[model samples]
Target: MLDAGLPVRAFFTDRRGGHSAAPYDTLNVALHVDDDPDAVAHNRVVVSEAAGALVTFLEADHGITVARIDEPTPRPPKADVLLTTTPGIALAAIAADCVPLLLNDPQTGAVAAVHSGREGLYRGVVDSAIAAMLDLRPSGAGAAGIRAAIGPAICGACYEVPENLRARVGRRHPVAVASTSWGTPSLDIPRAIETRLTELGVGPVLRHRHCTFEDTRWFSHRRDARTGRHAGVIVCEGPVGVSVPAPEDAAT
Candidate 1:
C-alpha cells in the first residue's frame, strides 16, 4: 500500500496478498480480466479489509461519466469516476496501466476514485470528478481544499505512441506530449494529470512515481497483456457500527 498523503485512509494496491492464480496472481481486484470469480471475490474482501469499510468498486467505461455512491453497494454503475460523501463507504478504482486517481475534500469529507486513461483524461474526467466533489461542498466552495493522489501507471519514458495520436492528445493537454527513451512519441499521463490538477486549483497533490510498465510490483497491461489489475482505494470514515457487505459477481 502506498500512502496517499491524506488524513483519511487512502492507498494504492499492488500485486500481492490475495487468492488469484498466475497472470492474475494474487491481490488482483479486477473482475473483467477473466480471472476466477471466486478468487476475485476473495481478493476484493481483502481490499475491503484493508480499507476498513465496505468497498464499492467502480467499473471504468473510459469516459468522463461520474457515478455517485450514497451507500455501500456490491455492484456500482459503469463509470470512470466514482464520487461519494457518505462516510464508511469505501470507493475503489481498478486499473492495469491506466491511472488510478483518488481525490478527497477534507472540508466536505467527500472522496472520489477515478479511472483515468488516455481517453478519459482527454474527455475531461478529472474536471468531471472535481465538479462532483465541489457539488458536495458549500455553494461557493472551490477546489483549493481538495487533495489529489496519482497512483502508479505507465510513465512517459515507456508509453510509446504514434506521432498523430500524441499530437491529438497534446492539442488539449500539451503536457501529455512526451518522447520515450528511444525518441518515440509518448504520453506522460501522470505528469499531464498533475498539471491538470494544479490548473484546476487542487492542492497538496501527491503523486506516486512508480511506473506500472517498469515496476513489477504493480500490474501493467502494456507490460503483460493477460495480467491482473491493481486498485487505488479510499475510505470515507463515519460512525462505527455499519457492517461491510460481501463481494459480488464478476463485472462485465
Candidate 2:
C-alpha cells in the first residue's frame, strides 16, 4: 500500500498480495473485470481488511456523477466520485491507467474519492467532486485545508492521443496539452488535475510520481488490456459513520 502522505489511513495498492489467478493475477479488487467471482470476492475482502473497514467501491461510468456513502452495502453505486463525512467507512477507487484521486478536508473532516480519466476530465468530474466536498463543509467553511493525493497514472511521457482529441481537452485544460516522449500528441492528466486543484484553491496535493505505464508494480490497462486493477483507499478515523475522505474508479 502506498501511503498518500496524508494523516489519514490512505494508500494505493499494488498488484501484489492478492488471491486472483493470472491476468487478474493477485490482488485484483474489481468485480466487473471478468475475473473469477470467488477470487474477486476474496480480493475485495483483503482490500477491505487492509483498509480496516468495509469499503464501498464505485462502479465508474466515466461521468461526473457523485454518490454519498454513509454505510456499507452489498452493492456499491455507479458514479465517478464518492463522498463521505462518515468514519469507519473506507472508500476505494479502482483504476488501471486513469487517475485515482483522493481528497481530505482537515477542518470539516469530509473526504472525497474521485475517478477522473480523459473522458471524465473533459466532463468535469473533478469539479463535481470539489463542489460536492465544499457542500459538505460547515457553514462558511471553505476549501482551505483541503488536501489531495494523486495516485499513479499514465504520464504524458507515454500517453499518446489523436491530435484532435488532444486539442479538444487542451482547449479546456491548457496545461494538459503535452507531447509524449515519442513526439506524439498526449495529455498529462495528473498534471492537469493538479493545476485545476491549485486554481480552485484545494491544494497541498501529494502526487505519486510512479507512472502506471512505466512501472510494473501497478496495473495498467494501457499496457495490458486484460490486466487486473489496483486501488487507492482512504478511511475516516474521527468517528464511526462520521468523518474522512474516500475513493472511486474511472474507465480508460
Candidate 3:
C-alpha cells in the first residue's frame, strides 16, 4: 500500500498479497475483470481489513458523474467520483493506469475518491470532484483546507499518445501535454492533476512517484491487457451515516 501523506487514513493499494490467479494475479479487487468471484470477494475483504473499515469501491463510468455515500451498501453506485462525510465509511477508486485521486477537507471532514482516465480528465472530472467537495462545505466555508493525494499511474515518459489526441487534451489542460522518453506525444496526467488541485487552492498535494506502466509492483492495464485493478482508499472518521444534504447533480 502507498501512503497518501494526509491526516486521514488514506492509501493506494498495489497488486500484491491476496487470492487471485495469474493474469489477474493476486489481490485483484475488480470483479468485472472476470477474476474468480470468490477470490475477488476474499481480496475485497483483505482490502477492507487493510482499510480498518468497510470500503465502498466505486464502479466507474469514465465520466464526470459524482455520487455521495451516506451508508454502507452491498452495491455502490456507478460514478467517477465518490464522496463521503460519514465517519468509518471508506471510499475507494479503482484503477490500473488511470489516475486514482483521493481528496479530503479537514474543515468538514469530507473526502472523495476519484477515478480519472483520459476521457474523465479531458471532461473535467477533477473539477467535478472538487466542486462536489466544496458543495459539502458549510455556508461561508472556503477550500483552503482541502488536501489531495494523487496515486500511481502511467507517467508522461511512458503514456504515449497520438499527436492529435495530445493536442485535444492539451487544449484544456496544457500541462498534460508532454513528450515520452522516446520523443513521442504523451500526457502527464498526474502532473496535470496536481496543477489542477493547486489551481483549486488545495494545498500540500502528495503525488506518488511510481508509474504503473514502468513499475512491476503495481498493476498496469497498458502493460498487461487482462491485468487486475488496484484502488486508492480514504477513510472518513468523525461520525457515521449522518446525511449531509447533497446537490441534485450528485445523484448517480
Q: Which 10-residue span in candidate 1 carries the lowest summed lDDT?
A: 243-252
Candidate 3: residue pairs that collide: 87-239
lDDT of 1: 0.88
Q: How much does each candidate deviate from the true structure in C-alpha RMSD?
A: 7.5, 5.0, 6.2
TM-score of 2: 0.92
Instruction: For model 1, state the Cα shift of residue 33 in Å.
Output: 0.6
Instruction: Give the winner by lDDT: 1 or 2.
Output: 1
Off by over 4 Å in 1: 238-252
Clashes of each: 1, 7, 1
Structural similarity to truth (TM-score) of each candidate: 0.93, 0.92, 0.93
lDDT of 1 by residue, 127-239 (tens): 99998887876698567757788999999999999999999999999999999999999999999999998889787677889999999999999989998999999988642
lDDT of 3 by residue, 1-252 (tens): 888876789999998988999988788989899999999999999989999999999999999999999986648888999999898889999999999999888767888999998999999999999999889776666566677889999999999999999999999999999999999999999989988888886666778889999998888999999989999999997532323332431211
Ten contiguous residues with the weakest lDDT in model 3: 243-252
Cand. 3 TM to true fold: 0.93
